[model samples]
Target: MARDRSRRSARGNRLGLVIVGVVLLAAGLAALAVGRGLLGGDLAATPLLGDRTNAVLAQQWVPYVAVAVAFVAGFLALRWLMVQGMNDTVGRLYLARDEAGNVEMPESAARGALEQEVADYPGVRRARARLTESGDHPHLRLALTLEDDADVAGIWRRVRSEAITNLRGALELDQVPAVIRMSMTAPARNPRRSLA
Candidate 1:
């Protein structure tokens, strides 16, 4: 699902930033300490990290190694971006296996069934459902329009018991994450008779 991918990508980015930030912070603080004479020695005489000749830094393959690392990092970043910008279609619900072959329920069919079931209840004027499959979980969103005097509590209880419970069972899932919204329709109005 797009939401799942977005969240995962965001978490990865945050973690990477935190690591990079800490490393930079530490390096900067160390440099400041050295510059301010906090290292208990003359700054000019302080031995540098590498040897005088710096043979490792002058290696012939160092440029090639740097190029390889940059290429890998760029490739990974592009992959993450592509995943984030993906289409959310073609998601499905998990169903049981049969003797013939594996059974899978299309998400559109599941959404339609849910909407129909909810709309069939008394006082429900209109209803719609959408299904999105997240990692290891399926999401269900419902929009319901009800009569002005509809029993919100009773209808919601039934919806939870009948629609949500059955959906979870049919999909063989532990839980089906849902977002339900309800609105009341305006009362019907009648035309007034003309005065004589």
Candidate 2:
């Protein structure tokens, strides 16, 4: 589910970028054509800046406003870039609290344990996991690399029934939402078959 949402968000961003690019490209081409008198003689002959426009530009506040707008645009661009690199993984989890003290655990520890458990499965070649959202209501993201002839359905069942159950017990949480992604590698070559 998390992967689906991420994919959808990425698709939307790409679509928006393409639309903006096309609009800008068209506007640029139209401006170039008009400037070169390809669109029409009258439009090309018309001055880009009239006396009224020049008067507005001459105002003392105009430069300040332009600089402010540039700064805002720059800030937004930087923010967007930062968002692109953001991951859903969460940090330290607050486990329990009492008169003694509060227990805290690194998110990596939970993720590592889950990954190791899943990786130990018969057909899984590798496993990666991330704990997202708050510790109180955590979400799991697991990626598994499997052998070519591995039983995907069986592995999924074991992961849900055994691995996730263990994680939930360790976390002492009633429910833990999870999403799993799997990929298969090429089958191993048989030397005897090759010789035959």
Find the candidate with the highest TM-score and give its number.
Answer: 2
Question: Model 2, which residues run further than 4 Å from truth?
Answer: 1-12, 98-100, 187-193
Taking the tens digit of each residue's C-alpha lDDT, what string does model 1 give over 45-130? 57675584578868999889989999999999899789768654437765766688767777888778888999999989999887
What are the root-mean-square deviations of the candidates from the true structure over C-alphas?
A: 8.4, 2.7
Error of 2 at 14 (Å): 3.5
Q: What TM-score goes with each of the models?
A: 0.50, 0.87
The local distance difference test score of each candidate is 0.81, 0.91
Per-residue lDDT of model 2, residues 1-196, tens digit only: 6768989989998998999999999999999999999989999999999999999999999999999999999999899889889998889776886899979899989889889889989999999998997867789989999988899999999999999999889888888999899999976676356544
Which candidate tops lDDT?
2
Deviation in Å, model 2, residue 100 alpha carbon = 5.1
- 184, model 2: CA deviation in Å? 1.3
Q: What TM-score, to 2 decimals, does candidate 2 have?
A: 0.87
Candidate 2 yields a Cα-based lDDT of 0.91
